[model samples]
Target: MRLSRAFIRAVSSPATVAWRSAQSRIFCSSPSDYRKSQPSMLKHLTSKIKATGPVSVAEYMREVLTNPVTGYYVRNNMLGPDGDFITSPEISQVFGELLGVWIISEWMAAGRPKQLQLVELGPGNGSLAADVLRVFGQLQSVLGGASVSLHLMEVSPALSDFQAQTLTGGGSQKADCEEDPVYRHGTTAAGLPVSWYRCLEDVPAGFSIFVAHEFFDSLPVHKFQRTEKGWREVLVDVDPEDSGKLRFVVSPGPTLASATLVQANERRDHIEVCAEGGVIIQQLARRILNDGGAVLIMDYGHDGTKTDTFRGFKDHQLHDVLLSPGSADLTADVDFSFLRRMAGGGVACLGPVTQGLFLKNMGIDTRMQVLLRNCHDPSTRKQLINSYDMLTNPTKMGERFLFFSLLHPSRLAAPTKPHGLKLEKRSPVLLPVAGFTDLSFS
Candidate 1:
């Protein structure tokens, strides 16, 4: 299944979107405010604040993004030239193709698991999945007769429909009961089975390659600001001046999240902590430790150096984060350091390398030249060149986007045998993780 994660679709805002070339909701109302008429969401948020005396920014984000009926992500078709932003896979096939190679590289490094599960979180329109599958089909010999299946975790019904159509070519079915772990099932154009789940907890256990692109950024982050009185969590409150609007306010004293989520020796005056993101990372680490697979994440992020990256996007232009509830995309730069810490010591964590270096390491240059040689049309060639530039240009998506990974500890160490009191292993030369190091290509 495929859709555009093409170049940034919005007319502006480059720093916030690299996978968006770099990277809304409409409420039903009058033509001018249709996208802004998130009546249910607005009323719910205000009422909750009125009752609880304001809510944490994390709580606010959770409602605005994943609130089932009217959450921004739940109701909108917000990708492509028609939506707020576009993606790399939509810009060019090379992006996903290289990712596909990385997946295979990891699989091979893991000794080619008998059953290969390709699980993608929040696969918008399935464009990345489709591109990866195309590569899988082309490299059939490399894959041998291994069993391969696709698993996608997504929430938007509209985007799921797009994913089904894109991946299955109209050949898919919905689960008979809502209680089923898999809500939908189908076979790809390549005849590989595909299943859909609502959450990561529901995905069937197996050796799986988990990939999340621009997913972590959407997870709710608890914002905190240090004060003379100590750390105070940021809360969203009903605007005193305008009941219809919302505003950022600080908690009076340390709350549960501020007490625990923030580090004791932290130096930053302000911080955005995604406890939910940490929980997800822990789950992934647990899975990798138990099932022997890998997790590859690509997104707009930093190595814990950034502070206050939360912002909104609507129709591609920057939107006020608290202006219209459920009417825009809200995201923050992922803190890879936070993820690494949460991954714990059970599995090996790899680079949060710049997207450009990662792609170049994965042989993007060679792949580009190969594609360019096979094409003759001037316009297509120009488009290909532009797409290549979009992905690799240091100023664009390249420098802004990052690739981070989690792998089984065994991936780094040779197989060991249990001795009387300890484990013993032979010194085997293992291939370095793809994209993280040039040794992968070498």
Candidate 2:
């Protein structure tokens, strides 16, 4: 729907209004101000919807999460305690250190490539990268510094600056000229200088170890619900009460459009389709297949065959994603099946293991024991115990979070299928729809 010039001006900043107006006059007659001014676009959408029909939840979500000016990721700082939620690296240095060890093991498994590209996608504040690098720095004899190149793929200029500071061991305000890890502004797969692209093709063809922690879940997801009539897609559109807000709206669109949304039992009420995540995984898989490498993905999600998992967070508190356009974090559960499929036929998929089990298997308990033995203060010991509990508790982040890995056939032996891959049946003693509401986009 077309938005009026006056309406755009009403919701846009003076500078934005002036720039957009100039662009409109010079490039096109239609006011494209809505591209930058989310409030205006939402307002326009809401007004049009009253006259039209209800918008689909997918359309609504696409607009609010990706709208250039007001979409969530485009306009907001979405990581860390101050933002929506704190990721593992942000929670403790130990997490990244252990990951570094995991990556090094994977590299060794790859026959220790003389020239290895260590790549990370959506590296927030670069904390994980820095921690990994620090750990690797100590194992220089095994890692041959000259042979390894660190590459980070990020988009936010603010985050890029933060990542640089974190990686260089400098104050947040200062830029380190000497400590540079090749930084790319966009997708490494795209052909933008082995640095910037919309996808992975941008990365130079080579053996690389990839890390994506708390990454995939953030990608936009298409929500679907099983109904007697068939499956319908959910959409996001402007909310009527708040001109600046966006809300989930269901649409009559067929679910077949989303490859991840396969036909399911008629009783299942919701499902999520992660087309973007699938595409990314497939691209990475193909790269690994062509060139020997491995990838590790860690995040909170279920490995079940059928379930709808969609939710939002803001300021460490659960918030209605529809409250504000581009202001809160919108996310959904990751489907490891899609990831495995994307790896084509040859790559090996591992885990879907509980974070608790993964960490314990990796010797977190031993690490904790060593730390406790070294510590003197009782308070410090208490703190460590508390943190350990929080990290290991099944009801908390421990059991709920999961870890999965993909490896090339030549690099590592195929992982034995994890025993915990099956979905647990909910006790009938609990409400029949107990878990059902938890998956709602609303």
Candidate 3:
């Protein structure tokens, strides 16, 4: 969820744009004016606002990102160097490798079911999945890799195609991919089977290992601002002075959101609540509770709800969210407290620990040193060092990003307390878990 600060740049100036235009004309044969290629989303949004008076933030985000016709995700290249932002998987293979190891360990802890489903939410370009699969392939001799299957929950068809290409060694024949009404199935480069579902509900019932890295942050959240009287739900509306412009407007009175405020008396005047996030958490909890498995959530957010975090990113730079609606990526910090509450009783919540501490305790430094020794190329070595630093540095992604775990109590089979999660104060035996060995729950 934490973007690489080094890669982040301020919005380009006029001179920079001129240089880009020249470069595009020279190096690129055909450059499409992205804005002109599609109908104006602003117009559509303005019309909606006119009809409805104002729209919820969630509605705006959902439509802006997934409008099917004019959505940002449908038209924009949203990952890697060419896109708006980069994910941890895109940063380095090491990140995904560690995650793969974690999944393997969790699988073993879950008793190594004969059939295990490895599910990833929002599998962008399938980079993480590829890396994880590589690890699984390497350990096939011991773990029986054939027992595992990869299931991805992806909505964008274009991104799905990109993921298919990446998983099948950068190029895949159209004939190899099969799609039905429910899901799409294919084989990876190493012949490992995979499937893509439109939603979590589509995945068949089974023992699952769920990974949601930077997934929940993108789900739209309702913003509420406190006034002297009470809280008012923020809404997006067309500016009165400038009809073409959009702005945030508070409701006339306190809305339904005030009922769920955790810190009503807190000095902070703003709060964000993602009802959709709650619903999805409930679904995940039910899936894992009924069918024994575990879930790993890695994102950037506070333990509780916060405010003024909803922002947009375009071309690796932060920008005015309303400037070019539906063009930039919008995301907010996840409230781990809300996730924990939605998990209910059957699922045990783990640490909402910083990603830096998790990686350090998991021996990222040791792994880096090992890789450094075998590397001959100076550039590759330098890149590795830089990525390592960026990932673990407190100022960068390390401290900003958080790691959380949810496990089914029955699957763990541990006589002692579970790892990472806060345990009863009087519990004498706390079982140590890898990567969480040093973590102490007070």
Local distance difference test, each candidate: 0.78, 0.59, 0.71
Tens digits of per-residue lDDT for model 3, 1-442:
1112121111101111111111111111111222433348888888977765566677778778878888887766699999889988898888887787677666766767787789999898899999888878875753664378889898887888888888875544333434453456788867777878877878889988899999899987777777665665666766665666777766655444444433556566787766667777878888888887788888989877466788889989986676677778999999888788767777888778888877766657767877888899999999999999889899999889998888887644563333333322211122123542221111
Instruction: Give the residue spans of candidate 2 off by over 4 A.
Output: 1-59, 169-198, 238-247, 253-261, 264-267, 412-442
lDDT, candidate 2, at 436: 12
lDDT of 1 by residue, 48-88 (tens): 77765666677778889888888998899899888988888
- Where does candidate 3 clash, by residue pair? none
- TM-score: which is higher, 2 or 3? 3
**Best prediction by TM-score:** 1
Give residue 292's lDDT in candidate 3 (0 to 100). 76
Question: Which scores better on lDDT, 2 or 3?
Answer: 3
Rank order by TM-score, top first?
A: 1, 3, 2
Q: Which should have the higher TM-score, number 1 or number 2? A: 1
lDDT of 2 by residue, 164-280 (tens): 555543322322432333333322111111232223556677988888887888776666655556665554444444445444544433433322244454345777756667667
lDDT of 3 at 317: 98
lDDT of 3 at 242: 63
